[model samples]
Target: MSGSWAGGRFGERGECLLAPNPGIMTLDGTNTWVLREPGSSTAVVVDPGPVEDGHLERLDEETGDVGLVLLTHHHLDHSEVAATFAARKGCAVRALDPAHCVGADPLADDEVLSVGGLSLRVVATPGHTADSVSFLLPTERVLLSGDMVLGRGTTVVAHPDGRLGPYFDSIERMRSLATAGEVATIWPAHGPVHDDAGAVLDHYLAHRRDRLAQVAAAVERLRDEGATPTPRAVVEVVYADVDEILWGAAELSVRAQLEYLAERAS
Candidate 1:
């Protein structure tokens, strides 16, 4: 909230229109990306964002001709108005999940989508949610990392549909892309855009490892005390310094960590 991340234009092909919905979970707001290749007549929209009147009006102005609407994930904030926006623009909305896609095939891993001479490679970076996916714009060396990587802080590995192991793999995948110079920047869904994709990814991975260790230590101490630690109990100890309003999100991460530990032990 204190940063200069008011979300604006990136390189030549990308422009971010920050949504109006700002809160604890969604930092700033959802970033609606307008992507257009140089000398192209049509634009490709990514994550139409929550259906806000003012935001939508601004977005409509920013993107005069949209050839396609793409969702980073099935998250309501990211995809709730994708269908409506796409319908209004006379374009198809495509996502990994069938329930959210409209008039387009489900996105496949490593699929290259070319519209208006712009190429977007679908990199299946799930684990924030099973339907989560990141787009790799090889031209700009940028990754539109849905909820996998954030600009300000770390991301939550939501339990149930979101698992730790896959999140680990997904981060590693992005890391490889960064190290290989295929991706230099990360355009996250929630926060601002990251120019240092490698550094940001490394920080994200390190934070996860450190938090997992902390959770394991807490779990061990609780077990030694003959107490079975629930997710909330683990959160109480591990995330004592964090805001209580975020304990619910921290609990989700703790649950994922516990599940990872259990799987490792097994």
Candidate 2:
């Protein structure tokens, strides 16, 4: 039991089954969500999580007769076992990316899917990755925030597949959802459930802004010293506080920051 998670039932129709693959990156491991309507025979599982046999067995025991499998993104940790698991459960796997889906079409924005009687409205929130998405469960006012939002700390907007502009837009969209009273809680894919949706969104937005500003300042300082302000150089100055193991992840975000700055200049 990590300080950030305790695997428990959340909202009116969801439960979290914490995976065994916890680490510096995946805090308390990946969260496999099981959602079902009251007295409904069918359930929907989200983020099947790595292809670990024990994890799959635990999920099978925790969620019986799964009707649909939903994926937030194509990250291996979250989507590796999805197709196999969905096949085992006799269900269709739907994701934003066609390659990740099995025997079903990719999801679209505002697309609503049902499991028994509960519904999940797909919210396209690409930032963490181009295919990243979040689900809004209107009945419980809970949002299944994939990697777009984490239950603890902040998320990395790694480059190539991630962009600062779209990431900010996605967070703003989620904030708008909270402001409109469409969502009140966050059912993140990692860590524990967040009770205050408004505060979490505010923090996520603030943290991204703060980090970008800090990275910008670092870039300026590096340039003043007549040195190249590359992503690795910027990481040394901006991500000094982060562990060396996470420097690789930090560098990825730094790359995205550099691209965003370059676009602004252009």
Candidate 3:
């Protein structure tokens, strides 16, 4: 998981077409997954990704006939070309958010989508963003975790739209799936794929709890020092080891943590 995650086929029915866009935030770029059952004539595309013309063209050429396009969320990096790509393939785009859907109704939680003999169960995992969703391939015991979980690092709990309470709940839900043996592998939308789903879910939960505790302690320490326990101030203390360039993302999580703490107190 430390090295670069070059896109390639995985599991029995999934292939990762890594988008060209990559950065600190995107890691190895948005993973545009092509899911098709063996011997199927058409495929299903997930998170069509950015507006890269070459990427879209490659998807069109490589995938042949795409039956449908699904979005994990409405983030520009993930869904910027969903509608356009779907239209080109003569398919409909489905997402948790209606605004992002094209020629198709919004996806419902627990909805079972069957295409090209592949079965994908929609799991609403709103945390990284309110519209975030994960697709569960029961036959493969794989979860296509959008931005809710990443292959390399922790996901940012984008505040305002992303709530800490919901984020925690979502992680817990995923953890339960892992514990129940329903999810054995995580085919995330970013970075590499994880074979140990339970371990990863546990790590994510523990990391969040550790960060929350650290944030709480930092707030108390700042208050005792007669300094306002602002999000940035708490972030400086809690995320001291993190790079300054990622402070903006840390601040968003800090804000969400603060809000979660406030709500719990009330």
State every prediction's TM-score relative to the real structure. 0.97, 0.97, 0.98
TM-score of 2: 0.97
Q: Tell me the tens digit of each residue's lDDT in model 1 across 1-266.
A: 25756788899999888898987878888888899999998999999999776777777777999999999889888988888788888999999998998999999999999999999999998789888999999989999998888778989888878999999999999999999989999999988888899999999999999999999999988889998899998999899999999999989889999999999999
lDDT of each: 0.90, 0.90, 0.93
Model 1 earns a TM-score of 0.97
Worst 10 residues of 2 by lDDT: 1-10
**Which whole-number lDDT from 0 to 100 does residue 122 have in model 1?**
98
lDDT by residue (tens digit), candidate 2, 110-186: 99997798899999999999999999999999999998888888888968899999999999999999999999999
RMSD to the true structure for each prediction, in A, is 1.2, 1.4, 0.8
Judge candidate 2 against the unseen true structure and give its global Cα lDDT, from 0 to 1.
0.90
Error of 2 at 1 (Å): 14
Regions of candidate 2 where Cα sits further than 4 Å from its true position = 1-4
